[model samples]
Target chain A: MEKILPIGEYIEKGINSLEQNLSFLWSAIDDGISWLVENMNDLFLAIPFVIILALIAFIAYYVKAGNKMFTLSGLKKAYGLTIFVILGLLLIYAMGYWEEAIQTTTLVIVSTIIALILGIPFGIWSAKSNTADTVIRPILDFMQTMPAFVYLIPAIFFFSVGNTPGVIATVIFSLPPSVRLTNLGIRNVPGDVIEAGRAFGANENQILYKIQLPLAMPTILAGINQVILLALSMVVIASMVGAKGLGSIVYQGIQQNDIAKGFESGLGIVVLAMILDRITQSIGSKK
Target chain B: MADDNNIRIKVEDLTLIFGKRKKEALELLNQGYSKTDILKKTKCTVGVNKASFEIKKGEIFVIMGLSGSGKSTLIRCLNRLNDPTDGRVYFKEHDITRDSNKQLLDTRRTEMSMVFQKFGLLPHRTILENAAFGLEIRGEPKEQRDEKGMKALKTVGLEGYEDQYPAELSGGMQQRVGLARALANDTDVLLMDEAFSALDPLIKSDMQDELLQIQNKLHKTIVFITHDLDEAMKVGDRIAIMKDGVVEQIGTAEEILTDPATEYVEAFVEKVDRKTIITAETLMFDNPIIVRFKKDGPKAAIRKMREAGVNVLPVEDNDEKFLGYVWLEDMLKLEKEKAKTVESALNTEVPSVYKHYTVEEMLPLITGHHHPLAVVDDEGKLEGIITQTSLIIESTRFDDKEMDKLIGEANEL
Candidate 1:
């Protein structure tokens, strides 16, 4: 009889070796990630609901208005978008999922911000050099296609199952789109425009900041939007590993077979996703 | 060596090769491999090959060639926009090719500015902001940059369009903004790479005239690139014709028209409207037989006319001023009437055209007058003479048959 390969066992053993050897590194990352998530979650929860709504409305208005001056016409131009954000946030509060919604929002914002900060440089590096591109491209592809549940396993092994692991898994899961799109946006800056920049004696840094970055902003924002959406989608999956959010409420309802709670929590996550999506879309659409 | 003070830029043996195997390409190039062969063996594209030239200060030196002839690449090399694979570029005393990044940027900010074929105006920027781009890049203060930008915009006739975005403007307006941007840079040298080629023909001509007007006032040393020979001839004080990454010829419009250096150059010059391009100086015979009134008698003049086999002889005064001409018939009549002096034979009612007058401008004088025209300098000194025969010979020198052959050959180029 043909022998079946024991690939799963080998992976488990290899992971065991890594955990045994890299315990200090793993604990350091775990501690830092925990400290960050706890503080962000606490900060988000501490903010009054009214203030959060005002902040979201302000962001919505700012993006929709385009010009920074808040004239009557500008406010009128932005009112539709602001109203949608207000209604979505108020609905989450009315359903008694305000705290869970805030926790999820905190998770999405924290992971996405960290991921983008890391992703953009990787993107620029990948765009600028062929070696970085060759090395980073397939690694990004692997990170993207690997199951989110699979990220949780190694993440749990390292950080040991909580919001820390949940945030880490979410970050890993959502990072590829940001990196890929930023790379694409920068690479897509017109060759003639880059030549024009160089011809005008702009240095590499100046060209990147003044020419490439401004022109690539829309695409980069689109990438950030993708990262946010991916992060939100991971919240429910993350709750299985003891992360508290609207995802935990949904998970609790599912486990208890309470359809009404499940539906309400599910609706809350959708509302948050819609509001974030529209605001980011508005930002990305600006010239 | 004596023209060193006037030389704004000099490029020596500049060569550029693209691809990963540039070393191999260079080796093959040194061994005399053709560009195609080098490309085949090393996967490299040769951009410019051994291009060398000098642009004098305040002169519009145009580099012209069809696409892929490396004219654009050679111009870029002058500013080190494309770091040449091998060789040096000298902008006045500074060896720009050897300059550090900071020094190069400094030179670009201060001494050189470029206008691009695509207009290269930032879409996100307003027209005024686009015009201010160069000054902004130089870290100039906002108030000063905007003031300078506004002045440049006014120069380009784009005054009211300052706050408008680039997209809101037309193509010609965008190019005007591009010109404004270059002007606002306040550089001594302007490198315009097909700056007007993207515009329609009418707009291109207008821009070309506007550029000449600007040059007349500002006297900025401009290195203009174009595929259109007409544009080159119109604007260039001296034009460098390029082919296959090499400079084929460099000369003024008349010099290129009268004496093309190669078959390719001859073909390029063949298509030029000689009536517009060839001036009276080009068509004039510099050493026409003349009888100086103080030096020669009527007999000597008749003898000279008979020996030279011409019906008309231009009569110059003792000061070599073009007094007029003496017709053979008139001279013979004077001789028969015992007129001792050639002055009696001289017809002072001679048609005169300035040496700088284009043949097209001299056509009316040529058609209305029976006598050959004398080409005189500003002082009315006899520079040369232009007869109808000379005009026809110079204008139709490229016969239809020869032109067909040149057109056939130009197609290959």
Candidate 2:
């Protein structure tokens, strides 16, 4: 205890340094938040691309179906999914906040992409080797069990602030489920299937791609669904780090003590969550 | 087809140990060390031990034992699925143990295909896809793969089930799909590890018949593994009876049934019904009384019987073929009835069977009929006699307890 530096001097030094950099950090955060708010129009513009991509996929599938039953089933599914998406849009419109909802959707899509890119390889690597599985498992457990707020703090520290920081926070919060589920899916494929692949003269890579991954697709898709839900939940918490979206509106409503505003924003989130959840679940169940 | 006499797989002193420090531990354990001591010294299990045998080309060579007899492990070792911890496995002229992984894979894909006990169909794939899986992996064109797959499926009597998923098929159908998968590859060697054991007994017998039919057409070298002795006898050209990872005896089915080399083999064979395995050919004498038929006269038949010094003579029609039998009593009766009809003295109660009838079929005829039945050829001519006494004698060939004790002692040595 005597050899350690005095607690008062340490506290004083920390305060002096914090004071010196506090203005810089605050201004950087402000600039990031302003950049996100200014580009809200661009985020809204991306919604048309999603609609176009969906329509193109639907048309491609529709033209390829030769059988009446298949074609009818495809039309039914397409109409059902379209109705779900329209209902979701109506819920957002009902809140009278189209720009904020679009921003939130953009952030979710980007963060989910990032999570998938990082999580899938980790899952594959874990499936390849027991050592990698053992090491990554505990880390995945930690990431999943650690509170969402904890991810936001570190994300804010690293990326400073803004939608990028918010995306980072959401990625960190949602990534674990995808990795864990992918590993589970690959590992749970029946032993006889793997043996059959081997007996068919498949190399390790061939077996992994042809047998393991395809068999694991449903479970992996379920995991992706979980990641989407987790990312949606993080959007509001990310507002505390100066990120804009529906989360910002919710936060503002909270500050001003406006109950209707908070409820509307929250309801919009719920609608978005339900739509994503249903789509992913339908895909998984079909498999 | 390969040369029938050439040895396709020669397993020499093969051993498989499952765990760490396997070789040294297995040696110590084999040297009579206690299990606890062996465990403390080196943690391993002896899955197979010094098993040696040769499977000839185009033969249905069965490896039979109870569960845990290492028969499955031994079959896998031939293809190097469960690599042996020691000794060599030669696939034709090539040493499989020394072959590179690529060579082994190539051999497995092209030279041999294994049908697992559980069928091992890719559950996600339909029957056609499952059957075509091997060809697809080998990079065959989709059209050719489907063509060969369909042909193979048709060969296994599964032609119309191409679109059905594995889950939609019954167990026997799934196993047929597995067979089709193996056949689709057109490999020379087929390894069946209890391939039909999971099916019900009735289905199993049907599958066995199907396998035999396929074997007749393909003449592929097959190494079958099973615990059921009857199944082995029904299908195996030769059999290896294994016990506790050691080969108890390896011989032709007839040789092993008639003369088991060890106590273990004898004990294993004892429970098997002997009559089912032995045939009339095994018990028949080469020479018997031959009688040609011309004129039907009781005095002539009596004179021929006296000259031949036999009590009975087979009577044939004008073409010198089997008509039936005429015994001395029948001849005397006929002599007494010489003034009467010739048909009145014919002894028509002679029981007979085909020369190919197995001992099992012949047993009841001999015991129930109270007479040595004549083994007739395909044309009903007398081939030989298969008596109950001959069958009993054949069965008691391994009855000497001294021989069993000697074998047990030899095993310890």
Candidate 3:
């Protein structure tokens, strides 16, 4: 009522001090991420698009058909996924935004990988210790539910504009599912089985590696699927803060009131997202 | 305590109280409070109360009680799966209670292993891999562990199931994998806590029999826990009956049934099939009336039968070898004819039983026989005689007073 809370000023003061003291640290992170994103995009573009198509198609086909390559039923089952992948990749390549799509793909891949590396361990810690779980749960909730746009501010302050901030924001938005689901998976493992492990003199590390992690694989895989999808969704929002790729194309198209450009570039993003999503989801679901 | 050298595991005054107020509960227990009273006052359940016993090597020491009895907790203490609130457990000469984590792990991996009630096999793992879990944890090489695991699987009659997942097996088969897992560790002690309680009666019986057969060959010191009195009788060399977390009595199944130490124990054995537990050696009469077939005449046999008030006298050679029986009526007729030895009047068709033959087994032999059945040792030496009346009386009453008198008479053993 009387401006008793000056929460925004307090945050601004903190941010100013952090930026003044940590500029060196921020630039280093910024340079490292930018280098990573550029190289990864260049690598994606350098690979023959046809080989990439073939790889995706091959993976999609095998997801449907297992080791039985020559079997008629397996072939019949494989054709659907293979054709879908091929068509999807061909459409994205034919679109004039192939390079931008590849750039977006690189950002998504890099962001998802980083998110998982941090999220999985956090999840495992939360699952194992009640105190860690209590402390982490609210933080994870904040990361997931705080507006994706709000994240760009701090992400930019920390790493500056470009793919680094975009990747940072994407990681923040997508990280919660991995942490939450990994914790769920490990916690859901039957207690008696764990008791059995302890009964047999299985040490802490042995129990985690042999019993907990293996049993939790499918659920962790599902969490990874969610992370990838969330990172892809952040592509357009990331474009608002000077991120590259399909998101930037769509952003310009909207500014210019060019409906055709916007929808076409947006379609390219959909095609890419669909291919990656189907592949990852199938991996988790595979027997 | 019987022989120090052969004691595999000795638990001394072990108490396990389960709750936050363990110290208070223990104090109340020490002050002679009842278990329920302790629980009411401190909100602590006494899992085991000053349970003390010695498990002999190569014998099945069963801890038996109903659900909520401290049997499961007591067994867990042997492996330190559940640490005691008080007292100590000794393995060989070492105090297991004082063992460091490394020593306890070594004990679990090399000296003792446990089987669980729920079959605790990993559903994701093959039967062989689950069986080899203990070995793998203890740092056995993959090849050696697999070989031992496979061998252990065969021992538990799960050879063909080695590659299959636990979900593929029935409950009983899953439990065999559990057994094989412990067996693969090659430990001397096997602590089974309600290991077969989850199985149906028929499968449970098969597992029990198989356990006994395996025990016969391996001779591992097994501490088995069961809610079933019958199973305790079937598997145990000696049993400790528990109630309200206190050990009621520890003795052989026969001793518990024939001479229960507490009312709670008596309640548990009330419906138990007595014939399966009462053997000829326990029910037979020692120093029975007998006619010497080598030198005694029919008149001597008649007089012996008359004095003993028996319809027949068992005929034994001078060597005390069981020959047969002679009917008192036949001996009288033969005596009137002045027959020399009782051998002519001997009824060699009488049924006989070994000393260890159970009353259930003796029932079929005793139905129509007028003469008593000879209870003999392996060498056919007459140890005692079991009459149908003694068999029926002892089997029906299921008490020790009659057997006590007979045992008192035969204190020579």
Index of the highest-TM-score prediction: 3
Q: TM-score of the candidate numbered 3? A: 0.94
lDDT of 2 by residue, B225-288 (tens): 9999999999999999998888899887778987999988888888887777877887886456
Point out where model 1 deviates above 4 Å.
Answer: A1-51, A68-79, B31-33, B40-43, B291-301, B317-320, B334-349, B397-413
For candidate 2, write residues A157-217 as lDDT tens digits.
5456677678777888899999989999999998888887788787888898889998999
- TM-score, chain A only, candidate 3, equals 0.96
Give me the overall lDDT of model 3. 0.89
Q: Per-prediction RMSD in angstroms?
A: 5.0, 8.1, 4.4
**Per-residue alpha-carbon lDDT of candidate 3 for residues B1-413, written as tens digits (9 for 90 to 100):** 45798999999999999999999999999999998899899999999999999999999999999888888888989989899999999999999999999898888888988899988888889999999999999999999999999999999998887888899899999999999999999999998989999999999999999999999899999999999889999999999999988899999989998899988888889899988988887888898877888888987777777789878778888788888988878888898888798767788988889978998888888776577789988888888898766787766773468776766777866
* Candidate 1 overall lDDT versus native: 0.89
A70: Cα error in model 2, Å: 7.5
What are the candidates' individual DockQ scores?
Answer: 0.61, 0.52, 0.72
Give the alpha-carbon lDDT of every model.
0.89, 0.80, 0.89
Q: Which stretches of candidate 2 lie over 4 Å from their true place?
A: A1-85, A148-154, B1-5, B29-41, B286-355, B363-371, B376-383, B388-413
Q: In candidate 2 chain B, what residue range of length 10 has the lowest lDDT sum?
A: B339-348
Worst 10 residues of 1 chain B by lDDT: B391-400
* lDDT pick, better of 2 and 3: 3
Give the winner by TM-score: 1 or 3: 3
